[model samples]
Target: MTDAILRMRGITKSFPAVKALQDVNLEVARGEIHAICGENGAGKSTLMKVLSGVHPYGDYSGEIEFDGEPCRFSGIRDSERRGIVIIHQELALSPYLSIAENIYLGNERRGRFGLIDWNRTNADAAALLERVGLRENPVTPAMDLGVGKQQLVEIAKALSKEVRLLILDEPTAALNDADSRHLLDLLRGLRADGITCVIISHKLNEIRSIADSTTILRDGRTIETLDMHGDGVSEDRIISGMVGRELGHRYPERVHDVGAEVFRIEDWTVHSPTQRDRVVVDGAALTLRRGEVVGLAGLMGAGRTELAMSVFGRSWGARIGGRVFKNGEEIRIRTVGDAIAHGLAYATEDRKTYGLNLIESITRNVSAAGLGKLAKAGWVNDNREYEVAERFRREMNIKAPSVLAPAGELSGGNQQKVVLSKWMFTDADVLILDEPTRGIDVGAKYEIYSIINTLAEQGRAVLVISSELPELIGICDRVYAMAAGRITGEVSRADATPERLMQYMTQTEEASP
Candidate 1:
């Protein structure tokens, strides 16, 4: 404790209607990896904002000490000057800019004339990239790299500032397993170099493996901080602290009341949108029964998402050919509107980009897809829209002060709820959920699974696309694995296992459906 590099005492922050944090305390030792664990809307991000000066000094009440010195940061720049940097969940990189340019964006390398020194900048960036284990060219555009590489770029940028304390928010939320392992190794390397890291993550297993100590928060208050190296610190212990309850079951159970076949896709084929001749989904087919929950499992680039989007309305492919049937009758769905008209809905995986309008109110976003139902003649009923949105908010347990709150203001889980509410308003008979619980805490994931069960019980057919095999096994009546753009294997709940699914996912030849 005497060697603590950062100490935040009695930190209290409040917004217009919500007291986000109250009397919160945190301490991080030098050159150690610390983790913050909490559910969505549990004040984890809010506390970090106060630390990084995103909320500023006078905006909150707190006592911050850095390196045995009282610190009062007025802005992010002030905090950065003291070697503190925060990398938010959403990477803030200019896509059009080169990797070197993005790295030294604000803190640029200058020559004698006070202009940017391109040669020195690229060379320095290349060295940082090597340190972060990325082998990409410094001149390459940031947008050209995948999400995992972009994360490395953000870290390289932080390193450029000679950071002492590096804060990462859900660093591995979008990464594949291999990429996630690489990032974790990089964090360990940084720790060895005498750098302190405070990570906010929902991946408890990662925290248990890497973190030296962990602090738990719930409902805008500090719960407790546990020593990872100490005894009796289990994943369930962390979950209980974060949710304020003993979660006996990570996934809720629902009685399987599957009915007759209600939806079918036959001979579905789609070519890449940019490369016209390349097939992304090759002759994929599946069937869904009424009041049933089906899962689609695959590795990255296995065409799971592509198949869903193409089936939704040819939304992401060229040369799309498919026959979609509802209630044993063929239905034409060439556009999003056509898909909706045919009682089909597809929720995208990237909720921020393709799902909700972050700038719009929750009510507006919820009513966006089904305004036709709330409209009379040429005029839309605003009152009806509000009522319907409020109904969904209550029913879905969306945590927000009011329906008028902007979608961007809510947490990742709440934003996803808004996305589901938007589609639910359409009263679609078939719901295609793509990564419905990605980047959310265990508690929020349970709630989402419960919602899916509710949808199935209402006689709606649900198709879920996921990367997690256990989730599919836990919630689906049947799971189908895809490999190389084809259905590789199909198994009922009783026959599903991670090993069997991986065998199917790695198959070179497609298996019979």
Candidate 2:
């Protein structure tokens, strides 16, 4: 009903080898939340870049209008000057800077003679934090905060600019449910203040919750934009639009019959590596049958990652008190080396940090986890390594020019494939995948799902940990729900639902600070 605040027409962009966009059109009504939905490499980011001046004028073929006026953006500053701010998927904060300092990095409050006023900076930062629903003190250094908190800091920084148009790319990819819900509420508050927003997210549920309209992009082409208040505004339709195909199910179907119990955990507990007398995981127990994909479902920090990591190699937390069993025989997994030898491999959730060597080539990264297998007498057989890496690269359908492509150069989906390739070569009977497709796109997600289904069909006991309930239910034969570091319930795949998992994910102590 309101005049369109932002209009983009005939947006076409190209990279050297790829035609990134093709005559895309988009419009956002003033003060309404507009969502861009696409699988990875869907030109969602590229489109946002064009709008925010990240690509600037002439670099891409696009026409843009703001508030009935045509403008050319040479750079980000040009757009920022008009109250347009973009928050990238990766947060851009100085680790050493205080929250106040980071928020006011470019535009500091000035006193006489252009001197910085520390008092006004902190006070204003606190006000911005309050506006964004962050309770942390402004004086705290950025490094000390968790990722969810850092995201709030980013929002406060945007508020400091008196922003009129805000762009958030995968804002909740790294947040817990509570933080995610809080952030969505904050966005609603910002909308109430007449700020136009464009959100790029893979989470359709979140998009349905907050958006006034949704635009689906597939391979850089804009599909139909759906009205949020319309009758057909559902997940299946949005996914269909994004991928240009019917997604029968969000997860690939697995046909493996649950066999004999191959992996078991009993009376498992892990203490915090630091901070004495703090329990991270407590009294957890599970059983995994051969050829079954079992999901670990829980909210972030509900001890899902902690339990997987500790069980894999005692690699996380301290004062470990857990017993792991293989084929009903208790095994000692004192180290990562021990875990691998005993047919266990854990693909970490944080691919850039604990999962892969980002700077290395894909071939090197693939075989890094199990170099011992690809080497002879402590010397890596280069030819054998190449063969192994190339085999998995083709098998995984990793999108790169060749195996020698730098791991960092690939998109998030490709990076995840490299991580899976690393663990696949380890020859582990039990593979624990933590958030395997967290930041990937839709097309890439299909490939990952197929690979997982293949693993289960091959009789590997797979333990999958996912924050997305649909993902867990779609892929796994059985789902294990956790709350407060304890196994609360297990659901058969036939009955597994987000509503059910959320019940357990939300159950918590009635008397906690």
Candidate 3:
């Protein structure tokens, strides 16, 4: 422990009905990229909150030693003063504000008259941006940048704080392959400069690639810490430590009994909502059979989402021309309600923003899409609503104290289950699940896959959109590759491979033409 920069001894935190952490201990070296791996709700984030003062010194039982000095932080500002910064999974930056303004938001440069010093702030932000490999102007609005660039801006903001022990919570969960690599490389650069970093992520491959050492947490307890280089740790070993069992198969076994075509789209064309002249989805067609789980595989901007949204009551596109068929009969879905009435439900990719009402309770969110069912002659029965939500909560195995808990308080997996409960309550025959298992742990992913299997077994037509090819291959009976708003190729489950999917995903327009 002589060279350890951060030491967390016997940390224990509890909420109203749950013990989030128990006797958690962590030691981070001075300049190493240490990783914290665990399933969702395993108390990894809770530990970091305690360290960063989000939980405060008195709220938790822990002894924290930084640079061999015992420290008790009462608030985030107190931790920041000692160069301890934590960047959360959801970024904290105002979209309308300029990059420079956001970087110096709380700690501003004041002039002689106690006025903001704009020139120095811009110059400082520019330097920090260059260090983080973001080339955008300091005066540019944060909304103008992409998700990857915005991540860099967040890192630059931490750099402005002179952060020594930087902590990142699932930083690459939303980034693409290229951006993820860049961010990992940037972490290496930070380590080279003698800054210690602690990263929490579910992506094991990334942890294997960059992490010098890894700490595994399971059920709010520290399982073990392994030196990645010294022990030559494999992914399977890490999985066993995380899940507490040997996972023989990456995906659960499924018996496919595909039925006749139940849903089909023909000559679907969608124009960009903002740029009406630009075509987003052009002449796209696909079919989903009853008792089938189909996948839409594509790159980040391949219009898979556009195609799904455009077909679902024209919710996304401006000028949409599509012919949707249900049970071999043409249907007109001009609105979300029309789509729901026509036996269709779409679980959006962004659950926090579009899927679930964060401030609302789980019961309310689960019953949101099927409120009409609880109504009797325009009057909702409170007893029936509670019973219905309770049934779904029990069926979904949502981990919460009660069905009335706020959706925002639940972890990513529970929030996803709530979203699923909402759609399942709608009882739609055709379900479009976009990024169903994104930002969730492996255990939660298995549960979600089981749910998908149940839906398929019930003869529901399910279409999944995923950036992770392995997930698509594991769950889907057939996979359709989309590129430039068009279906490039379709492959059966027996012949799908990551390489084959990538070939179709990146197929050139000229070749298709």
Tens-place lDDT per residue, model 2, 1-513, is 559988899999887768889999998999999999988778999998988898879988879998878878999889888888999989999999999999999899999999999999999999998888888899999999998899989989988888999999999999888888998999999999999989999877899999999998887898898999889788888888877888886666667777899999998988888865888787888999999999999877789999999998899988888688899999999999999999999999999998888888998999998989877888999888989989988898888888887898777898998898888898888999999989887667888999888888888999999988878887888888888877877888888888877776777741111
Residue 276 accuracy (lDDT) in model 2: 50
Ranked by TM-score, the better of candidates 1 and 3 is 1
Which candidate achieves the best TM-score against the true structure?
1
Give the C-alpha lDDT of model 1: 0.94
List where candidate 1 sits over 4 angstroms from the true fold: none
Off by over 4 Å in 3: 510-513
The sequence of per-residue lDDT tens digits that candidate 3 reaches over residues 1-513 is 348999999999999889999999999988999999999999999999999999999899979999999999999999999999999998999999999999999999889899999999999999999999988999999999888989999999999999999999999999989899999999999999999999999999999999989999999999999999976598889988999998887788887989999999999999998999998887888999999999999998899999988778888998899799999999999999999999999999999999999999988998899999999899888888888889988898999888888999998998999999899999998999999999998888888998999999999999999999999999999999988888888989999999999999997461341
Misplaced by over 4 Å in model 2 are: 494-503, 506-513
Writing each residue's lDDT as its tens digit, candidate 1 over 332-442 gives 998999999998999999999999999999999999999999999979899999999999999999999899999999988889999999998999989999999999999
lDDT sort, best first: 1, 3, 2
By summed lDDT, the worst window of 10 consecutive residues in model 2 runs over 504-513
Score each candidate by Cα lDDT.
Answer: 0.94, 0.88, 0.92
Error of 2 at 23 (Å): 3.0
Better of 1 and 3 by lDDT: 1
Models 1 onward score TM values of 0.98, 0.93, 0.97
